[model samples]
Target: MMEDTPSPIDRHITGLTGKARPRICYLATPSGDLPAHLDKFHAAYGDLGCETSHLAFFRQPDARSILVSDFRARLLEQDAIFVGGGNTKSALAVWREWGLDTVLKEAWGSGVLLAGMSAGAMCWFEAGLTDSFWGSAYRPLDCLGLLPGGCAVHYSSDSKRRETLHAAQQTRSIPSSIAIDDFAAVMYVGTSINTVVSWRTGSTAYQTYCKGGTVIETALSAKQISV
Candidate 1:
């Protein structure tokens, strides 16, 4: 977790759940559910007084290690689901096999705040610009569609991300999409943008779309936050 002075990241995420201290389930399937990644999540949210837990779907096919009757039951216990950034393609593959895709849809409808950057953020939308397929190039992949249109992350850090997303929008390969620079996030409250926030000052999100055969990139004003 990038530091937030007032910890607005924690506050906002927890706020979405209407809980002073949210129960957060960190899913690292996108990163193959790496132990280190899970450790990081535990360290970050745990520091903020969140009741933190995790779900791993790697070599353990049964998912029994999560200590729940079913994944759905485990998720229902959480007020928020945070996905770690990684190979979106592989994550979605395992999610479908485990029937987690539908489970997540149910979770979202029930008001479990969904969040993650990169693969985590992309999972909820209809499509996303990802490097998961080629590991280097941006490709638009159809996603869960919990949120409208498409999404992209690491806008400021990834060299090819902005141009690829812009071109995709111009070609109508994806819908009018939200592209978030590293350290910035767009909060979607039931398919509507609640706010654009960042852990770093001046980091921003963008609403990119096609306009008359050309791509338009509009910066979304953001509130700076840190913990």
Candidate 2:
């Protein structure tokens, strides 16, 4: 979620681009290209002196004006890509259909910093515990596989998330994973976690896996990035 003002996490992300004025592109596909969400993104990043832009799939005003090639070109030109949180299942389906998944992988390989929250964060991993099924219990959903292992978002706020993730690991439904609480994020360089950072005090991430026929949750040391 985006704050009313640029948060420390936001600054950290911008800094990762290693540009004085990074070209940041927001993808709101998970949220169905919600206008309000796009507004929030611009409001936050714009203030940070970022060259901000967003790609909207669901509500493209001039769909005819933007071709698939145009989308590809625009995305490749960005210094960073920020995905928004929403329905992971649906988002992946759309990305696959539009071949944006491949484009994203290429972008990452080219060193364009990829980041997001919740569903956005989950999309980068091999699989994730998702509530995208609506009425059904949280299930492990396959994701982009840009990063290895599984992911669990909203680990603290959503009580069922931790339970479902643990069960998935215990049953070998998904591999050893990381569970991230709100206001916290894990930074990965290649396939390994470089560090964990949190914008909220006491909010952190965890390494979850099944060991010796039991589920173990080990808290990852998080550096406070909050101002």
Candidate 3:
């Protein structure tokens, strides 16, 4: 059921998909949250001689048993997974309700390559920038905590977004967070981290947390988000 779609995310993780080294793939969801961000993902894997297995719909494989069986198990077959950027809570809810959390964790911890962006990446951090939206309906929830404590996605300057980040700071307490400037990514390659730029990439911005004063912009290196 993989279809062609456009992409808003810079597809930063794609640059690292080792072509010669094949691996199993698990592309994350909210495929709808985003409109057309699948084509790039597919092409990345195509270069690697791998394909993205959809875990989004497997949550309900069949009211008629028409989509085959054991769909969740099939997601675990790949060597790597690509988690898409979407609403963190919504995305995690699907996986938790469908049991993909246990599935992916076991798979990744046991060596399933974890490749993700936005919500996918945010899932790894401790506190996510959930309040950067124009609405005030949802509160903070526990993310997957797969990465360092502070970081956010599509984090940048714009009238609406700036206000959102400010509010997120006041309410959510994301003392320090990251801004992925439209076309940049702070890639995590184990303890050794770096940045990957593409398109109209801007510098990766970091807002550090101080005790009571304004948040400090400690060091805005392109890739050094962590200390």
- Please, what is the whole-model Cα lDDT of each candidate in the order they appear? 0.82, 0.88, 0.53
Alpha-carbon error at 174 in model 2, in Å? 1.3
Error of 1 at 114 (Å): 0.8
RMSD of 3: 5.9
Clashing pairs in 1: 3-227, 4-226, 4-227, 5-226, 5-227
Between 1 and 3, whose lDDT is larger?
Answer: 1
Off-target runs (Cα >4 Å) in candidate 1 are 1-8, 59-65
Model 1: per-residue lDDT, tens digit, 133-189?
866679999999999989998888876898888888878899999988877889887
Better of 2 and 3 by TM-score: 2
- Residue-pair clashes per candidate: 5, 0, 10
Give the per-residue lDDT of model 2 (tens digit) for 144-196. 99999999998999888888888888899999999999889999999999999
Candidate 2: list runs displaced more than 4 Å: 2-5, 62-69
Q: Which pairs of residues have clashing backbones in candidate 3?
A: 6-36, 6-37, 7-36, 7-37, 24-78, 24-79, 24-80, 26-81, 124-146, 124-147
- Single out the weakest 10-residue window by summed lDDT for candidate 1: 60-69
Error of model 1, residue 63, in angstroms? 13
